[model samples]
Target: MNEKEILERAYLEAQKIVSENSFREFDTSLCENVDFLIDKIGSNKSIVSALATSLLKKITNPEQDIRLHRTDFENGYSARSLDTKVVTPFFKRHFPKYANKESAFLTLSTRERIKWNKNEGKNLKIRSKALKRSFLNVFEQIEDGNANPRVYLNYLFAKLQALSSKDELIFQLAKKQSGRSGVLNINLIIEMLQRHFAEKLSSRLPVVAIYSIYEILVPNLKRYDNKRLLPLQVHTSSDKHGFGDIEIYGDDGKPFEIIDIKHNISIDADLIFDIIKKTTTTSIDRYYILTTFPDGFETKEIEKAVNEFIIQTKTQKKIDIIANGIIPTLKYYLRFIDDYNLFIKKYTNNLVKDAKNSTEIKTFHIDKWIKILKEYKINNV
Candidate 1:
C-alpha cells in the first residue's frame, strides 16, 4: 500500500477501536504513556505532531530501525516534507484545533537534518522532563517491537478524540447559559459586552464579539445591506489580500469595507500609516480601526494623521478612514439593532463555532455575562 493509504488504514483501525472500546483490551504501558503525554503536554501540539509523524514513518517500513527523527541522507529519508505536506494537512482536516501549530520538523527544517536520537527535538527542550521521557519511552518500545504499533496508534487517536469531545461539551454548556436578562437596554448590553472584552483572556474574544455584532448590524443597516460581510479568517493566517480583521465585499465582489480591531494597543501615527499602506491597492468605501484601548487616539499626531488620511482617501480613493474605541462603536451600532437580546444569542453561538478561540475564552464570555445580567436583574427589581 502507498504511504497515505497505510496511514489511512491505521486511522480507520483506530476509529473502529475507539467506537467498539476494543482498545481497552490492548491497553499497556504504551497506552498509559500516551495518556501521560496528553495530560502533561497540555497545548503544545508540535510535540504531539512529532510523535504521530515518527510513529507513522516507523509503521510504514517496519524493517528499518527508524530513529526518532532523521533527514534524507544516504542512511534514511527526511521526515520534513512528509510532516508538512502530508501529516500537517491531515491534522488540519481531522483536528482543526491543532492545525494552527506547525509540526516539530517544520520548525527544525532550517537546521541540518541531523538525526535527533531518542525522539528529542529542539522545541521539546522547554517541555517537562516527564513529557520528554514519556515520548522517548514510547518510541523505544515501538522501535524495538516491544509494543504493537497499531495499538499505540489506537490509543493516541482515541485520546485525541476524547479531548475534542470534552472541549465541545464546555462550548455547548457556555452557549446554553448565554441568555439575555429579559429587558433589552442597549446601555446595559453594551456595559456587559465591555466587561467581557476587558478581561483580555484572549484577543480572539473581542474579534469574535465584533464579528457577531456586525453579523446583526450589517444586514439591518440599509447602506451596508447591499454588501456582504466576509466570515472571520483564521487568526494565524497571513494571506489576507490586504483585507482587515472583518471584511465586507461589495456587489462587484470587491472589498467594500474593512474593520480592524486592536486589543488595548495604542493607536498612533505609525499604526495608521501601516493601515494605509496595506489598503493602498484596494478601493474600499470605508475603513474602521476600532480598539479596546483605554485612551482613544490620545496623541495629536494620531488625530492629524487620521484626519489627513480621511481627506486624501476621500478625494483620492473615496475611502473614509475612521478610528474609535470599541465600546463607543458598539454603543452606536447597538442603537440601530432592533433587539439587543439577539446580540447575546449570536455572540454565544459564534463563540461555540470559533475554532481559533480557546475554551477559556469561550467560558469567560458566558461567565461574565451571567454575573453581569444577574446583578442587573436584581437591581432593577
Candidate 2:
C-alpha cells in the first residue's frame, strides 16, 4: 500500500480502537511489551513513533517483511521514508503533542551491518544486555508472526494514551477557589501575567503570549498602520524565512520588523552573531531581541558587542536592533491597550489552540489567571 493509504488505515484503526474501546480486549503480553519499552525508554517519543509507524506499515502489507526499517525491502517503498513523509505528518495532524520534523529512524540507524536482525538490540545504545534481550524479544514475536499486529497496534495506542494523560492538580485548585468580582487593575493584571511568564510554564507559552499582545497592539500603533503582523509560526518550526520568532510585513510583503523572544536564556555574543547573519540578507527596518531573563544580555563584553552591532547594523544596513527585557516591553505595550480583558482572552485562545503546548501548560495558564483574579478581586460580577 502507498504511504497515504497506510496512514489512512492507521487513522481508521486508531479511531476504531478509541471510539469503540476495543483495546480493552488486547492481550496482556502485548500490553506488557509496550509497558516494558516505556519503562526502559521513559517516554521517549522517537521510539514510540518508530514502533507505531513500523507496526502500521506491517499491518498494511503483511506480505512484505519490515525487518530492515531503512530499506525498501523490494516492495518499492522505504519504511524510513514512510516514517518521515507520512507517519510524521499523521502524528502532527492527529497527535500534535509528539509531532517532530524528522523520523525516529534518524536516531535508530539500521545501516551497514547493524540491521534489525537477531542482534538488533545489541547494536543499539541500550547498555544492559537484559534490556537488549527484552527489546529484541518483543520485536522477535512480531518478526516471527507470533504476535498479532492488529492487537499489538491496539495495545501500543493504548499505552500512548496512558502516557499522554493530563495532570489535574491545578484544575482541582481552580475549581475550589471562589471567583473574584471587582474592577480590573491593569498593573495587577500585568504583574500576574509577568509572574506567569516567570514560572516558565512552557517554552512556547511566552512566545504565544507575546504574539497575542502584538495582535492587539499592532493594529492601533501608527507606525504599524501600513505594516502587517504575520501569523504566529509553530515554536518548533525551523524555516521561518530569515526573521525571528515574530515577523511583520511591509506593504511590499517583505519582512519590515522582527522580534525574537528568548525564554529564560540570556542573549550573548553568539546569539548576536547569528542575528547579524540573519539581518545581512533582509532589509528589515527593526529587530527586537526580547528575553525573559532579568539580566537581559550576558556579560559586559557581550553587552558592548550588542551595542556596537546595533550601531553598525543601523549605520550600514539601516536595521535597528534593540535588546531588552520581555516583561518590561510587555508592560510598556499594555499602557497602549485600552481593554486588558482583550489581552487575557487572546492569550487564553492562543493557549487553547497551540499544538505544541501540553495539557498541563494550558490548564496552568487558565488556573493561574483564575487564581490571580480571585486574589486581586479583579473579575467582573
Candidate 3:
C-alpha cells in the first residue's frame, strides 16, 4: 500500500479503537504492538483526541512500569524483613495463647478473632494506598521533568514507531524517520505535506481533515471539459495558485478565488504577504483564508499587512482577505497548527544544507505544498 493509504489506515484504526474504548464499557488493549503508537495516534487532531490522550494515562509508561516493578522487588525485601523483625514479634505478644501454639488458631473468642481480622484487613488497605501514593509521586516527578533527565519520555515515541505490529503505517513512519524507506515520493506529493505526512499521527491527521474540507468547498472544478475530477493538481507555477490548499480557475480562463485552508488559528503579516505574492498575477476577486480556530485566531497581522501593501502600491486591485471562523464540519476535529516550528525546507526534494541554519528560516512556497496535495488526490484525473 501507499504511504497515504497506510497513514489513513493507521488513523482510522486508532480512531475506531478510541471510539470503542471511549465508553469505558468496551476498554481493551489495542492489538498494535507499537509501544506508544496507539497513544500518539489518539492524541490531538481528531474528534476523539481526548480518547488518545487518555490512552497514555491508561497504559503504564514503559519507564514507569520498569521502575514500579523494581520498587516492588526492593519493597519485597523490606517487607520480608519487616515480617521477621516487627510482625513476628508483635503477633507473638498479641496472641497470648500462642506462647506455645505455633499457629495461633488454638483459642480465642470468636468476636475477638473477627475484630483482629477486620483490623488486619484495614491496615493492609491503608498500606496499599500509601504504596500507590508513593509510586504516584514518582510518576508525577517524571511528568514534571524532575526525574532522571536521561530517562526521556520520547524514547517511547521511537520505540512505538519501531513496532513489530501487523499495521503497515507504523512501519512506514519508522521508515520515513529512518530515511531508509517510506513509500510517498515527495516528488509526487509536495514538500510541506511530505513533512506533515511523516509527523506522528496527532500531528499529521489535521492535513486529512483540511483535505476533506477542500473537497467540498468549490462545487465543480475540472482540468478538462469532458472529464470530471473530484481533485485536480494545478502546477505551483500556475496563475490559478490557491491562497491556501486549493485554487480553482473559472471556465472563462481567469482566476476566480483562492482558498487557503489553514490549521493555524491565526496568521501573521508575513504569511499574508506570502499568499499575496502568489496571487499577484491571478488578480483574483477574493481571497478566503479559512482557519480552524474559532476563538484564538487573530487576523490583525494580515489586516495590517494588507493595509500597508495597499497604501504603498497606490493601485486599486480590489483584493481583501476574509477569515472564515472555522470549517463547521471539522470544528470538532480542530487542530492547533503550530506555525512557529511547523515547517522544514527542502531543495530538489532533499534537505537544504547551508552553512547556517536553513531549518530556522521559513522559505518554502505554500502553493507548492497545495500542488503536491492536489497531485496526490488527483487519482482519477
**What TM-score goes with each of the models?**
0.78, 0.77, 0.28
Q: For residue 201, what is the lDDT in candidate 2?
A: 51
- Candidate 2 residue lDDT tens string, 1-381: 676675566567656676676765776666666767755443245566677777777787776555666553444346667778777887777666565556655553322235455655578654555555555665677888467676676566655554444323444334333232345556776777776765545566678778888899889899898989887765543223447878889999888889998888897766766787877766888888889887787677877887887787678777788888787787787788887767766765665555333232455565665667566665542
Least accurate stretch of 10 residues (summed lDDT) in model 1? 355-364
Q: What is the lDDT of residue 207 in candidate 3?
A: 33
Report the lDDT tens digits of candidate 1 across residue range 110-155.
Answer: 2345444454433445347667667667777876655767667657
26-67 in candidate 3: lDDT tens per residue? 212212222323233221111011112212322323233222
lDDT minimum window of 10 residues, candidate 3: 353-362
Q: lDDT (0-100) at residue 187 of candidate 2? A: 73
RMSD of 2: 4.9
Candidate 2 stretches with Cα past 4 Å from truth are 1-13, 19-22, 33-44, 63-65, 72-77, 101-138, 158-182, 237-242, 299-305, 356-381
What's the residue-level lDDT of 347 in candidate 1?
Answer: 79
